[model samples]
Target: MRELTESETRVLFEKLSKYIGRNITDLIDRPDEPFCFRLQKDRVYYVSEKLAKLASNVSRDNLLSLGVCMGKFTKSGKFNLHITALDILAQYALWLKPSGEMSYLYGNHVLKAHIQKMSEDCPQHQGVIICSANDQPMGFAVSARAAVECKTLEPTAIVGYHQADLGEYLRGEETLA
Candidate 1:
């Protein structure tokens, strides 16, 4: 994947700000701050943190995954590209292995915790966590039901399957494009 030029980055940020109805001037004054000030305060920091991680990866999958994670976690309710938060968290766990702070189980647990937190804090976003936890078959069934309801109210991209496949597909790939 081609690295985004400085101008492209600026344009992309502007577009995102506009799409979310955030004032560009406010964001310029505090670039480190989140775009979702009151609508979904928790999501602002969550998204900013995810973007910081994506900035280090050269793969398109990684970038897309980051975008999906942001959209899912924030429950933006628009399908762009389906990327699962579990996948990103799992990758972070692997990267943090050297620090001995996280194992696969630990990572999975953290993912579950985050999902649960999101569900509790944002009832409207509860389906996002449910859908991403669908690897558990039973969870998937429940999520599917929730998703059906969510879909009637608003469109949400399904991401669990896509995220599950990304790790395998990118394993030996030479380029990101």
Candidate 2:
């Protein structure tokens, strides 16, 4: 995966910093120095002493698992899922390994084009899917089942910028099931 350009990195940091204001201190467990930040419920939570202590003990492998698990849990029972991660290209391997039902729309072109087409094709049902920048379709069968089980047929849309790490495609499978 390509490293983010300096400008892109700066943009990411700026956005993160804006959300970390005031709570910046909470991210550091030790008063003298600190490392790492926590994300919770679409919000970045500054780690307090207690939380930091727990984070410190977590291993790298465990941390990766935790991240995937968190992503899965956050997605719970949604009929249609849309994820848009800035670092998707770099983190695809670790991010898309969880077990669950989901539909990941990756890449700006595919996502945008698909959404536009879906919009033009199905205009009646709207506001069904919520988009995010950090979701990936992992399990093909599971996602198909979820999509079929979903009561609402409202079209959903997502926007991403990379195509390499989007995982498997299960579009028509849902309708067949």
Candidate 3:
């Protein structure tokens, strides 16, 4: 495990900021305990300072993982946010209709007809947290159309592209363990 380099930090934050926006600061400057990001096997872990310090005592070979597995960096250096980071992104998310929830969970793109509502300022291609009507975080997606555009679009028009979803937890159970 090691610290993220300057370039890696930039890449990671750029991907995260797309979904959570300025809330990234709240992750760093927390009221309870300070948390930090650490890299282990290309996967970024969001760990508390105390736990990270304790984890430092263990050798790299034996430490399988640290805290929450935020995501991983590809060989090409692109960061992919994992479903595990949903808790943090849930704060500012796009709410979907109940009809859309199942489709999204099945890894299908969100259709305009399924959208209950979205943020007023949501723009096309922006990363957004996808939630159910009950406000449950379902996954993450990239908006396919701007808020205004959706109003004039057909019901079957794509509104969001699935990036990651909770269904992955069950589908990739073997790999997750």
Compare the candidates by TM-score and give the number of the best one: 3
Q: Which model scores highest in lDDT?
A: 3
| lDDT (10s digit) by residue, model 3, range 43-73 | 9999999999999999999999988999999
- CA lDDT of 151 in candidate 1? 30
Q: Whole-model lDDT, candidate 3?
A: 0.91
Model 1 C-alpha lDDT per residue in residues 18-42, reported as the tens digit of each score: 2222433454345565432111222
**Model 2 per-residue lDDT tens digits across residues 1-177:** 112345543443443332232332343355655543344333223333344566657664454322221121134322222232222112212122111113343222222223221112122212122223344322111111122222343323222223322332344346654
RMSD of each: 13.7, 15.2, 1.9
Better of 2 and 3 by TM-score: 3
TM-score to true structure, per model: 0.21, 0.22, 0.91
Clash pairs, model 3 backbone: none
Order of models, best TM-score first: 3, 2, 1
Comparing 1 and 2 on TM-score, the stronger one: 2
Ranking by lDDT: 3, 2, 1
Q: Rate the local accuracy (lDDT) of all candidates.
A: 0.29, 0.29, 0.91
Prediction-by-prediction clash tally: 0, 6, 0
